[model samples]
Target: WTIAQVKAVAQAYGESAAMLLDGLDSGEPVGALAAKMQEAVFYVGDAEYRCLADIGERAHDVSGLEFVALREGSRWKVYPVESAPGGDYFVVEQILIRPRDAPESSPVIAIVDDDPLLTAEMCSYFHSHGYIARPYNTEATFRAALGENVFDGFIVDWLLETGTAEAIIQSIRQSRHGDAPILLLTGKLVTGEANEDEVARVIQQYDVKPFEKPAR
Candidate 1:
């Protein structure tokens, strides 16, 4: 495919992702959106080459399709023809997206608070905001979840049974999840029991906003 043709198709598929993001933001059903997105990608360059799936699997010269295959380890891997080695490939780009545990679900949020009442309230708020909230009473449970889960955000209380909020936030930021949004919640900030200046320093260092309790 020509550079111009490739750019057009890329733009179209890029818009597809944006549309899916919009659906998520609007609280639309993720199951439906994922089902639609999983449909066969058919935007090939013009009518020049017919885009086909499963061209008899191990065929060496699979034509009428817009893909090229490579043998990796013990398996044959396939990629779009436009992105294959040295063909008409103009460029290949990786689009960063929210990692999904299930294709049909909203993003996940993690809430770390020792108080069961506060944790439940925070989880309920996030659920109403279109995100699935996972709440933990201890850092150990939250840390265990990190092994198998990726979260879109974290709501952390300043004091924890296992550690201070600053230490917890620092640990999470350094972990494999990268930089997910961390919302710092503190009753001390409202009551002037904790040093606001020092707490603000931690926020400045971590680039996460300090949020006082939201109105119910």
Candidate 2:
């Protein structure tokens, strides 16, 4: 083939390929086109060309097509080309999107409360808010979970039957999950202590909720 004629055909094919690719810029669709092009450009010869030089000494001349293929899924897929009637159809490309797990879907919430009823209620509340709530009846269980799993936040009772609420708070404060937010729930400490100053102090010191009343 005349070098000039070969170059023109390659350029025309490249420009048309590029323009078609521009409309399909997502990486998935581009990859599909790349796979198809690789299938199309398979060769059986001893041609030495600059573009296909690296593929193998006897590979098909794919310098132009390779350039177009490389930029298939990118924003630069917008090159102009002219069409001739009855011309061959460029290879068809497709993208197949499938469902995958989200990285942030399983955020954990640890609830440190001694009452089984309270623990169940807290878990229900957190789950309602789209978090994975793991409730424990003792400081030991909470500590074990803290050691084994990562928690994004916590909901702790202000008073545990085994010890002061401070003990659980301090235990959680010292664990690897120390950075997690803690929402402390307390009975009406003196019948009416859920005031703004107390809530602010609790939120500032731990992270949200000086006290959420136990569910009725």
Candidate 3:
């Protein structure tokens, strides 16, 4: 097979592998990864082969990526291969993995905010979409909860009742739960004294996704 054929084969395999992921929406990025996996081609003999095991072998910048072997009824399929370790993969975590050997559990998100109404809204939204949301009303409570539980993601209010968002973030990064994704919610102009420069700095420093308040 020519390079195009080899790549096409890889693409087909990769997308199928990605689709095996559980709990993720698996957006339009479905085919791109398998195409990328093909990019790591290694030639062997006349028939050609793509090493499915080596798709994301050297990733360091990658986050949130996981591979799982799924068995539904009589079917069995694995992503990035069961042979690969979590340490071998890097970059952005593109897969939702729930290994067949491991017991399945719903993903959880930690929502930190001072407003009861906002926290309730956020929790309700996530719960409706299959995730379990844990809402904290203050920085102290958030930090305390972090010590006792693990979360898949975080949504923090930039302005809290008892602490500043910057301080809360800094403390979070210093904790064991820092590796989780952190998203910020603040008005476009923000409250307190945080100017655009300060807000931008916080976003960059912590690698957070910021959601400015919607216009009324």
1 or 2, which is superior by TM-score? 1
Which of candidates 2 and 3 reaches a greater TM-score?
Answer: 3
Number of the candidate with higher lDDT, 1 or 2: 1
Locate the minimum summed-lDDT window of 10 residues in model 1. 88-97
- The digit string of per-residue lDDT tens for model 1 on 1-216 reads 475665676687775434444544556465554443311223234422112222234434435445544444433334666544442221112111233345336788888889999889878766644578998999888889977888878888876766467878888888876588888887776687667887888889987777776634
Off by over 4 Å in 1: 1-105, 214-216
lDDT of each: 0.63, 0.54, 0.62
Query: What TM-score does prediction 2 earn?
Result: 0.44
Question: Every model's Cα RMSD, please?
Answer: 17.9, 18.3, 17.5
Clashes of each: 0, 0, 9
Candidate 2 C-alpha lDDT tens digits along 1-216: 475665676687775434543675565654454444322121114331111111112213333332221222321121112221122223213222222235366688888888898788768866644468888998777777777888888887766767556656766778887777777777756665435454456567765556547443
Worst 10 residues of 2 by lDDT: 75-84
Candidate 3: tens digits of C-alpha lDDT, residues 113-160: 888888888897676445789889978788789888877788887767
Provide the clash count, candidate 2: 0
State every prediction's TM-score relative to the real structure. Answer: 0.49, 0.44, 0.49
